[model samples]
Target: MENTEFRVELVRLVDESYPVVVGRDLEGSVAEFLADKHPDRRAAVITDSNVASLAAEGLLSSFGSRPADLVVFPAGEASKTREVKERVEDELIARGFGRDTVIVALGGGVVTDLAGFVAATFTRGVPYVSLTTTLLGAADAAIGGKTAVDTPAATNLIGAFHQPAAVFIDLDRWLTLSDRQIREGLGETVKHACIADAVFFEALEDAFVERGLSPAEFVRDDALAELTARRNCEIKRDFVTSDVHEGNRRMGLNLGHTIGRALETAAGYTLNHGECVAIGLALQSRLGERLGYCSPSDVARIEALLRAIGLPTKIPEEVPVDRIMEAMAHDKKGKAGAIRFVFQDGVGRLVVHDGGSYARPVAAEDVHAFLQSQV
Candidate 1:
């Protein structure tokens, strides 16, 4: 037998980049940030009901003499839909805001995702900034420029790779978040540590054992939250800049997202994104151990850290494994019937498939078996 190999080159002319500003009292600085970033553009502020009251209104008022428009939607994963996207776009059109408009997303992950999606599509892509209020948005959703809206078929099914002009993480805003919301952000904060930095994982462990740090305490401690948020952003910046289109190392950022997203969709948006991600990390770590990519001790440590941070490490009895598997089939990482997954080689290292895919396709039966083990 003879061996044959072929190579293909795909070049993308992506020059998009943005600054992630993490600090306390950032709400008061939104106007300064926007004025310097998009000085001449009109502003279209997009936020949810909850955030509108807590941060959006304050942000708009901070704009001072700057002219701006405001649009508030009901808060939740449900609002990240095509219908909302259309309504938002129609409102912008009705107000006569053109491409010169700068969409300002002031809220949590949902607002950032939805507003970014709107910014990407409206008038063939306008500029946008992500002023995140929640920890989840600051740590994960607001940084990478992966804007999206959910669909009945799946979550984040319709979206675009539109980077923001800038991302602002207001540490003071954590004061307004419920404890549950802070915990949701920890789901991703722990995930970034598990997949990218072992020392970060250890620091998180120290925060728990020595400093008595927990998700509940995140709101009470701005210094700790700022450190965690900044590290997550640095890791994400490295990945997105290295592989903007998710062609290689960037996909590794989806460490637990394969199953995580499925859990979110299967739960019908009832489960918080980070809650589902915490469960997904638990299940995926076990799967990694089963396939010899990760050690059992490492899996145990991962679960323990997640638990210590006030995150759930097990699939809820309410969310059926079968339903989750069905949802995974429609995940964006799937090709034909093969679902691509990113597994950890160890803490801080990711498994790269023989074909150079950060995410490798696993058989459906294998996935089903993995799911079964969780139950």
Candidate 2:
């Protein structure tokens, strides 16, 4: 029998690697960065109503002689919907924006997600940059190429893998974040540490304890904040580079996101994403212990770190467990009503399930039992 043979040439779909500028006072560099990276593109700064007057203004001012426009939507998670994406896209069309337009996401996770979806779909796809304002945006949302808007059914259910032209992390922007917003960012930072870097987790813990700072206060500390932002980006970069399309290996990055997204959807946009993720991490870590994949001490340690940062560890009494489970069943990671959960073997490591998938189908009964324990 002749072996099947075919010549395969490697074709690179994405030719350029964008820079992630992480530092204080990086606002001055935005225009220069755009000039260097996308000199001919028209700029469309997409921000939320809350951020329009804050970091958004600074970003627009930095545009210098470059042609740019601002599109601000109502602030909050409720705005991260298909309706909002369409509205922004319509604004771009009405303004005569073309394929050469560059979308600048100028707020937290929601803005990035919505504006990114718009960029991803506009004229098929367009270049975009993230000028992250909130800590959550800096640490996670703005880094990975993953972009999406929420649907009535689930969080980020409809989206695309549209890489940004660049990502700007201006540390000074975080000063304007509320304490709750700071905690929201810490949620992703903690997940990054738990999934891949024990040392990072310890560093964050030590920083909080040594300085005697609450989670919110700790996020405001210059030294710790910078380190956290840089480290989280590095960890995410490793995952994204290893598996740009999520395939299997990158699914490890979804450690707590499986259940976390469910909680966010069930809460109806009330619980900020990072807050819901903190709860998901705590519950999943506990589940890992129950399944004998990790030690009870592991669960306790994770919960303690999250609590230290003022993140909630338990399911809110008001959020329905059944609703969460239903949402989990419909999660993008799941298939045919089966829920795929990513569990940790220990801090800084994910447990590879028997089939070698980073995601495992856990029994609904087991998940229900765990939720009951949480309350």
Candidate 3:
């Protein structure tokens, strides 16, 4: 990819603020952003082994003359845990990092969440920037102030909302991803389109068919992919700006996350976050239609797009529905023993339903029935 530039606006969450800068070659720009925000002359970078080699090198090179440290974690969601957090914190302390130090997260959502949490809690919070390398991170996880580490019982159970100083998105990294990783990111992209922009969703569907593109090709076209990324980020920004703490409107972003999170835990963190989210989106759309929130045609469209993009539109055969529901009971969104779900009223609109009134929240019976319909 030649030199390319694109702009993504800043979203100021209540009591926090961060800029989401989307462009090519943003690895170098991260240093400039950090210098302006925290010129304290010391910083630490937390990244997974896989991404550290591919992406973190550019970021480290960018911080010329500044004192910086690198901390590596295992490369997967399983690393987002108490053990990893303790290790990262220990490294920071051993390095003699003070409150003046900044943390640069240089990987996917898991790295950003775990590292950002460390930055947020260490010495009552220090500055950090999000150098998102994955598409899912760039579109959703990286921009939102929400950071977390997972517990044995639930995913992202222990966490905080620590907004980053800035988010630098380098589209060039998309070219290096395997087809599977690219498909994983498309799941979230589809979610954004379903909940916020019908036009964007339709455009992607048309493009998928027209070019005979795989998920990898679809997301690597910098111009087209960046448009989708910006749209998803904007959807999240609008909600976060209105309900910064996720007290209300912002909860809509959890549309498929309720089931998605449950699926992750049920799979023992084996399923990719975006892949679980893809299945959750399909399930939720079916539920929406059953509840009169959407038309059958809309649900079909969603399923078709996900399938075309190489995402799983149904729950894995190995995981039973009962196990998934049991996991849902432990979701962070559940309250008073009832799981709360962000369902849709239609494309681009959402409704949050309390689970207490229904036996298997999200009307698991209804969801199961819908699944049968798909089969």
Which candidate ranks first by TM-score, i.e. highest? 2
Whole-model lDDT values for every prediction: 0.85, 0.85, 0.80
Task: Please state the error at residue 302 of candidate 2 in Å.
Answer: 1.0
For candidate 3, lDDT tens digit of each residue in 130-161? 88888888778887788999997766889998
TM-score of each: 0.88, 0.89, 0.87
Lowest-sum lDDT 10-residue window in model 1: 209-218
Please provide, for model 2 over 16-62, each residue's C-alpha lDDT reduced to its tens digit, 9 standing for 90 to 100: 57888888888678889889878999999999998898777677788
| Model 1, runs deviating above 4 Å | 1-14, 334-339
RMSD of 3: 9.6
lDDT of 2 at 300: 82
lDDT of 1 at 237: 86
lDDT of 1 by residue, 245-329 (tens): 7778888888888998888888978888889899888888899898899898899888888888788888788988889988888
Off by over 4 Å in 3: 1-15, 267-270, 332-339, 351-375
Q: Which residue pairs in candidate 3 have backbone atoms (N, alpha carbon, C) closer than 3 angstroms, thus clashing?
A: none
TM-score of 2: 0.89
Candidate 1 colliding pairs: none
